[model samples]
Target: MAFRDLAMAMVYFSQTLIGTVGNVLLLYHCSCLHFTKSKLRPTDLILKHLLVANSLVILFRGVPETMAAFGLKDFLSDLGCKLVLYVHRVGRGVSIGSTCLLSVFQVITISPRNSRWTDLKLTAPEYVSIISILCWILHMLLNTIVLMYVTDRRCHKNITYRKEFEYCSTIRQQKSRTILHAALLFLPDALCVGLMLWTSSSMISILYRHKLRMQHVRKTNFTQRSSPETKATKTIILLVSTFVCFYSLSSIFQALFTLYNNPDRFLVNVAAVVTGGYPTVSPFLLIKHFPCISNLTDCVRNKKTYNVKRIMQLS
Candidate 1:
């Protein structure tokens, strides 16, 4: 393999392994086995869904990109491409929806009691299942069109108009169908990003005001800034920021590919880099926020270090 391909393979492998491991651990802790509480928070419910989505994204995206880096071509059959790409898109759409829901719920949770959204805070947990079902239904419906163009046909014969999926042949769609396809893919993305921005901004505002109130009340005393609501809002903001950055970068590369009719390897690599950002960063951000996770991480790290030291002494 060329140096570039080797580097890309390293990036893909490391991100895939780290992201999958962290997200799996997060899922386990947030599942029925909660060491810290008897009941899960509404946001925790949303996060469970996000973890599943991120795991799927990591698997489909990381595996293909790594195989391509090592010069493995056409490893997927027609049915495999359809299933893998469909699941990837669905997972991505669910991730976007879950992030939006998480942000909105956090905003409601922190809103003043007399605010218009107060009712949602009290009842958000009840609607979690409904929201998850709607998200899956919407994405599954939107992604059904994937079956039309994804195939195992040879694509190198006409490289000028072909989009570069690892194991799929590109087929031309009608103009009207193309517009509808774009709408189906990008409409929900735009809505999710807009909603997240609005809600996350509101959360930051509420957090700032709360900080000011705390400062006023405890001007003469030392106070902790680590209230549960405060910490949760901060985590939401970090997650949203990471998502926006990666999503924007990927979309820009995609637009460039479309404008130029086909992208070279470098642009494709840049796009691939964006795919790993959120799945890798989110788990660590969440780990620091949850006390249970923090304790778990410390114990694991200590044990691993002890094993390494013992191995060195033996060697």
Candidate 2:
């Protein structure tokens, strides 16, 4: 493989492995075991669903793209292309919705009793499920048109307008894509950003109150910052940060591809880099926020160091 391909493969493999492992552990912890005294809380359920969605995204996006990066021929046939792309898009939509719901839920859950958000926690979980179902249905219907338009081009052939292939959409359908793009891409993204901003602002206000309380108390407990509420805040911050980084990078590359009529080589490479960001960072984020995970990490690190010292002493 060329140096570029080798580098891309490393990135793709690492991200896929790390993201898969981290999300899988998170899923197992929340789903198969009781990590908290609270039984099957709304946030726990949301995390489980999010991990499933993320795992699907990694599979559909990471595998084929990695093959293509290594200069392989079209592994994804026409149906594969349509289905994989469909699942990736739908999974991403669900993830965005779930993250938004997580943020909103956290804000409400952590809000003071007098705050407006407390009223939302009572009903948010039920509505979040309804919204998830509606979102899946809507995204599936919107992407069905993709199968009608996309077909398998021959090996090593780039996509180009061909007269013989009636599979390429008519002018009317092309116009429809414009409308669908606005509906699917712009609307959902805007809503996510709005929700994130609201949640972040609320978190800031909470932090301000925390600081003020810390200042007034001369001998306050240092452990207050390490409480469950604080840990949850940190976890949400990590989630938001990862979401923004990955999605923003992908969106930028996609826009450049469309606007500049760039070569697929450049666009694909950018996409590969952007896509791996989530899986690569997710494990570290989980490790950082969870005390149990921190303890486990420390134990592993100390064990390795001790083994190394013993070997040196024997030498």
Score each candidate by Cα lDDT. Answer: 0.80, 0.66
Clashes of each: 0, 0
Residue range 108-218, candidate 1, lDDT tens digits: 888999889877777887998899889989999999988777766453454344565555665656769877898889999999999999998899888888777777675
Q: How much is the lDDT of residue 214 in candidate 2?
A: 76
- lDDT value, candidate 2, whole model: 0.66
Candidate 1: segments with Cα more than 4 A from true spot: 32-37, 153-161, 219-222, 297-315
Q: Positional deviation of 173 in candidate 1, in angstroms? A: 1.6
Each candidate: RMSD to true structure?
6.7, 8.3
Question: Which pairs of residues collide in candidate 1?
Answer: none
Per-candidate TM-score against the hidden true structure: 0.87, 0.80
73 Cα displacement, candidate 2 (Å):
1.4
